[model samples]
Target: MLSFILRRLLSGVVLVVTISVIAFLLLYAGGGDIARRLLGEDASPATVAQKASELGLDQPLAVQFGTWASGVFQGDFGTSWFTSQPVSDAILSRLAVTLSLVLGATVLIAVVSVALGVLAATRRGWIDGLVQVVSLLGTAIPAFLIALGLVIVFAINLGWFKPTGFVQLTDSFSGWLSSITLPVIALSLGGIAGVSQQIRGSMLDALRQDYVRTLQSRGLNRRTVVMQHVLRNAAGPGLAVLGVHFVGLLGGAVIIEQIFAIPGMGQVAVTATSQGDIPLVMGLVIATAILVVILNLFVDLAQGWLNPKVRLS
Candidate 1:
């Protein structure tokens, strides 16, 4: 297990570095001089040259990347081209908001998917049909459309939640929850749909296994057998599906954040990419890569824990 974890960590580090280098190169190669963009297209060539020199944009790609890589190791992500603020600071400021949304949505997905999936697997008729219908709708609809509809119905019409803006947790826990509710729901629906379907399928297979029948024949109650034996075995594949859904959630958060005007890493990523803020864009890419790696690591560990047969190495 330790070796497995170490291997995963090393791979994650390598992945982050590779992604960072690729992002840097892409931004570097992308046309439109950074200095000119900063100074305005109308700026004189001499002014652009001076700005580029000052910003180290005049340096060779290798030297510039070396400097940026060194700074990354030292916890400095360089300064944003437009804001002139440290990239780390800018990202850190919005990290909490994005984390809140993602984490909240994850919790909701876990609870809803497991409950619905288990119920659907155990029950018959209308309940199973309803779960299937929900799964179909969730899989069929795009997150942004769901978000828009939710905003129109719940926020604009019912006034159940604030349509946009975020409140920090430190300020008011209730306010934070309230502010994040719609966004979380929007982000979670598709994840819930995917995870529940996987769970339902896995559970059905587990229930049909010989071990489940053996457990039942031994006088274990249906619920106990299903919960203790079936769910555990079913969770492995469900977990793997959840990991994939999580990556999707991250991508969806970008669109949801924009629609809701929430201040988050997603919003920052959009702005940085659109404005050609290379440092900030690089920071976002590396940060997202790290997050994805970490989440997958957790999913791996969970699967290994839930099923002793899963060989981590």
Candidate 2:
């Protein structure tokens, strides 16, 4: 297990470096005058040139990348081109909001998907049909549309949740929950559908296995056989789906955050991209890559733990 973890971590390091390099190059190569964007449209050519030189935009591509990479290695993500604030500071400020939404949606997905999937697999009648219908609609609907619908229904019609803006957890736990609930639900709908389908399929396969019947023949109750034997075996694949879905949720949160007017890393990313803020965008890209790699590592570890037959090495 230790060796497997070390290998995963090493791979994660390599992935982050590769992603960072690609992101930097792409943003750099994309046509844009960063200095002019920072200075303004009315700035003279000479002024723009001076600004670019001062910002090291005049440096060769390799030199620029090397400088940025060196700073990254030292835990500095560089200052935002527009904001002049450290990129790390800006990201860290919004990280909590994004994390709250993602983590809440993840927990919701895990509980709802597993329960609905298991129930559908075990019941195999109207209950299963209902779950299937819900899953179909969930996967079919776009998350932003879901966000709009939720805002209209819960925030406008029911007055249960705030339609926009976020509250920090430190300020008020209940406020934070109420503020994030709609966005979390919007982000979770698709993830729930995908994960539940994966779980249902995996559970069904596990139940059909010979050991399930053997356990039943030994007089193990249906619940015991299903919960203790079937579910455990089914969990590995379900977890894999969940992990992928969770990574996607981070990307999806950008639109949801925008629609809901929530200040988060997603919102920051959108703004940075539009304004061609290279440093901020690079920071977001690296942060996202790290997050994805970390999630994959955890999923791999969880799968190995659940299924001892699975070899990590």
Candidate 3:
């Protein structure tokens, strides 16, 4: 198991490096006057040229890439052209907001999705049918639309919560939670549907297995047969889907965040791209890619743990 984890960690390192290089090169390929764009209309041509040179824009492509990559390795994602702050620091400052929303939504979705799926699979009646319909509806609707609808109903019409702006949790927990609720709900809708579907399929398959039938024939109660035996077998698929979706929640909340006006990493990446903040955007991409790789590796480890026969070592 240790060896397997180490191997995956090595792979993750390679993946992050590859992703960072690609993101940096793609941002650089646009060949715009980054310094001029950052300086805006007030800067003269000579000033822009001087600033660009100072920023090392005149260096050869390979040299610039090496410099950027080295800085990244040293945990320096460069200074943001707009903010003149270290990219890492800028991103980390907003990390709490993004993590709070993502983690809260994830926990809620996992509980709701798993329960609905298990119930629906075990019952196979009206309860199951109703859940399936809801899941289907959820899948069909986009997150941004859900976010808008939620804001309209809960904030604009009902006046239950403020419609926009983010507050730090330490400053005011209630205010922070209120600001995050709509966005979390919006982001979780599609995930809920996806997880439910994956769980349902896996549970149904588990139920039809020979071991499940053996457990049923042994006079085990329905609850035990389903929860203990079936759920254990079914969890593999659900975990796989959950792993992929978990990574997505971090970077995929762009639309939902924008709609709810909650500042997060997704919002940061969007703003960075628009302003051509190459370093910030590239850093965000690298961070997101690394997250995905790590989650996937963890999923594999989990699978091996759940079924010892899989032999991770």
Over 1-313, each residue of candidate 2 has an lDDT whose tens digit, in order, gives 8878888899999999999888888888674787888889999999999999988999998999999999998999999878899999999999989999998999999999999999999999999999999999999999999999999999999999889999999999999989999999999999999899999999999888999888899999999998888998998888989999988999999999999999999989999988888899999999999889988998988888897666545
| Per-model root-mean-square deviation over C-alphas | 1.3, 1.2, 2.0
1-313 in candidate 3: lDDT tens per residue? 8877888888888888788777777777575777888788899999998988988997877889999988887878898888888888878887787888888878878898899999889888998899989998888998878888988999999999888889899999898888888888888988899998899989999888898878778899889988887888888888888887887788657777777777788789888888888888888887778768877797888888878765445
For lDDT, candidate 1 versus 3, the one ahead is 1
Candidate 2 deviant stretches above 4 angstroms: none
lDDT of each: 0.91, 0.92, 0.84
What are the clash counts of all predictions, listed in order? 0, 0, 0
* CA lDDT, candidate 1, residue 82: 85
Ranking by TM-score: 2, 1, 3
Candidate closer to the true structure by TM-score (higher is better), 2 or 3: 2
Number of clashes in model 3?
0
Candidate 3, residue 167: lDDT: 88
